[model samples]
Target: MGLRKRAAATVVTLIAAFLLPLAAQAPAQAAATAWTPGISPLHDGEWVMRDIPGGDQADSWLKNCARASGIACVSVGQGDGKQSIFHLYKCGTRSLSNFIDALSVLNNQTGGAEVRFTGPNVGTYRAPANPNVIWKFPNAATYDFNTMSVC
Candidate 1:
């Protein structure tokens, strides 16, 4: 074959090799997104089911969580806006640190420390810091994260 054709073939092979690994890694990276506690179907005390209905607030429930938690939290509404479940993690100012701490504990056999925010004064803290935060869908979602604020 011509030198130009040979060169083109080599370039295509190199490109495929480089892109294949990244494509394969995409799912793993996305899997980590939902690895946060409570969502895992495997854990017992680590997860629970709650029911809350959605009414008006529909566009940005996570934003509503930020408003309600009085700290920082992210959320996802269920059943096409039927309910909402918030994942309250770091104080927002420190998500990177919390993610690192959580990943370490989750990857370890020791599991992770469960943080108990039972008292009214018990505010949002980093993961491994506040592992027991309300993550399940609320019993009665009023509309957005306001009613479902993580614990």
Candidate 2:
């Protein structure tokens, strides 16, 4: 009986010891990031390029815009710092794939062509025509742009 009681007590102690630290870390883990709903970074008619690279290889299609002087490209920055470079054609709107944590956009369009980003609430925001310019969103998941219109 004594040994059983001791074994039960030891098991309880071990369980408590393991769970205490996790409990302590639970709040921190549950804490929301800057991109979370605690604060919204996007506003109506706000330019997503107001602020500011690459791991995974998720290259999107670069079809149809070949008529332009230079190839226009766009890259989406993922939350884990991985990026997907998309070759965009001009004269039409392209829908983006479902990407996780789109933190930034790189407008690598040439010939001084601006890439227009359209969202539901944010309206239309045009990226700079300058090639190789990177635009970072204010938060990690701020701008949820639906389509890109390269001109």
| TM-score for predicted model 1 compared with the true structure | 0.32
Q: Which stretches of candidate 1 lie over 4 Å from their true place?
A: 36-151
Task: Give the Cα lDDT of each candidate.
Answer: 0.33, 0.48
Candidate 1 weakest ten by summed lDDT: 100-109
lDDT for predicted candidate 1 compared with the true structure: 0.33
**1-151 per-residue lDDT for model 1 (tens digits):** 9999999999999999999999999988865553222332222223222233343333234334434322334333343333333333322121111111111111111134232222123233322323224333332221211111121
lDDT of 2 by residue, 1-151 (tens): 6999999999999999999999999777754322211112222331221111343333322122222344454545444444444544445666644433553444555666776766676676676665434555443233566666766
RMSD (CA, Å), each prediction: 14.7, 10.0
